[model samples]
Target: MKFKALTLGILIASAGASQAATVNEVFNGKMLGTNQRYFESIAGVPRDSFRNDHTFVVQNCQITATIGDGKVTALRLDLGQGCEANLQSFIGEDAPKPGQTITPGVFGSGQRYTASCLAECGNAADPSAYALWQAPRSAGGMEVLMEMVLAGDKAMTAADEWEKQIKQAAGMDYVLATKFNCETRFNSIAEAVFKDVPVNAITVGYGLPTQRCN
Candidate 1:
């Protein structure tokens, strides 16, 4: 009987070790999640109606979730191909500098803006840029806020400005396309989408990071 109990204990310990190892491997960059959502952009004739320009596919974009929380929190996407120049134009000259990362949050001085840059800007049609958002912890099933494509590098800079903006921009379509409980105002954006969701006991930055952007 003692032998059987010992064996059972070992088995349980092994199982836990396996789960921890898997999560560690993913977080530490050994493995990557396979699921990714793709968004495409459309093209039209140049404002020059007389120009014989052919309409071509703009870009192929994909958003891959980095964590295993069952919802997409952070994502990575490829900006449009060979359009580094165009991308720079969209995001603008003030790109994120050394020690600067464009995350979600409110800027300083009570500015009326929420910045959500993520890697992608939020242009569903254009894959050049993308966004990542985390819904307010209170919103159940809304844990992973929204992810979207950006036009270019400029959005990257703006993303560093604030958190609310990140959520608002990344989840813009979600707010528009879906029936989420929310309140939108000129200086602020809030919603009840996360109200029903249980607030996580763990503060976001308190624990070790579970995901990393490539």
Candidate 2:
């Protein structure tokens, strides 16, 4: 039950109510990794000033688990600016140049990285999400594909286990209240929580054009 095509097929195939249920599972169950130090440091930094640390500066990350056919097919770990920068190094670029931005995303910091463990979630032909996140082909870079295959019974528990690790390593709370869904799941979570579709459209999930580590 991998998510070979990241499209709306599941939403159309499954009943609205069922798709909604799956969305709720993904929303409420998804855990957010915290960034205690980042928030703490944010308070200290001046409102207009910026800090430069060629490493992951943020203190939190998030996970979204989409269930299909009675199993978790996709588990996307949305990295914070800091996390994204940290991982930039692994793909290729590890440091920031004279005028380039490195306080956020770059390869070497290892701050942000997406690990797609399952083969059924993104492109079945390509089982790893790492490829999708990798540098573009034109840049002579690899693509980071979505990999979410490690969510079986025992492995599924890893999501919960990560909460404890987050607390211990980062000394922060991991209670999450927000989730991003395309439509089926998005509408479902909104209906379950607010009893309707989300309006006012405040962007709270991933894929922003800009970000910061600290």
| Model 2 CA deviation exceeding 4 Å by range | 1-111, 114-139, 149-151, 175-214
71-131 in candidate 2: lDDT tens per residue? 3332333433432322222233422342343221223222222223221234444221111
* Minimal lDDT window, size 10, model 1: 38-47
RMSD of each: 21.4, 23.3
lDDT measured at residue 34 in model 1 versus the true structure, 0 to 100: 27
**Model 2, C-alpha of 75: deviation from truth (Å):** 17
User: What lDDT score is found at residue 132 in candidate 2?
Assistant: 21
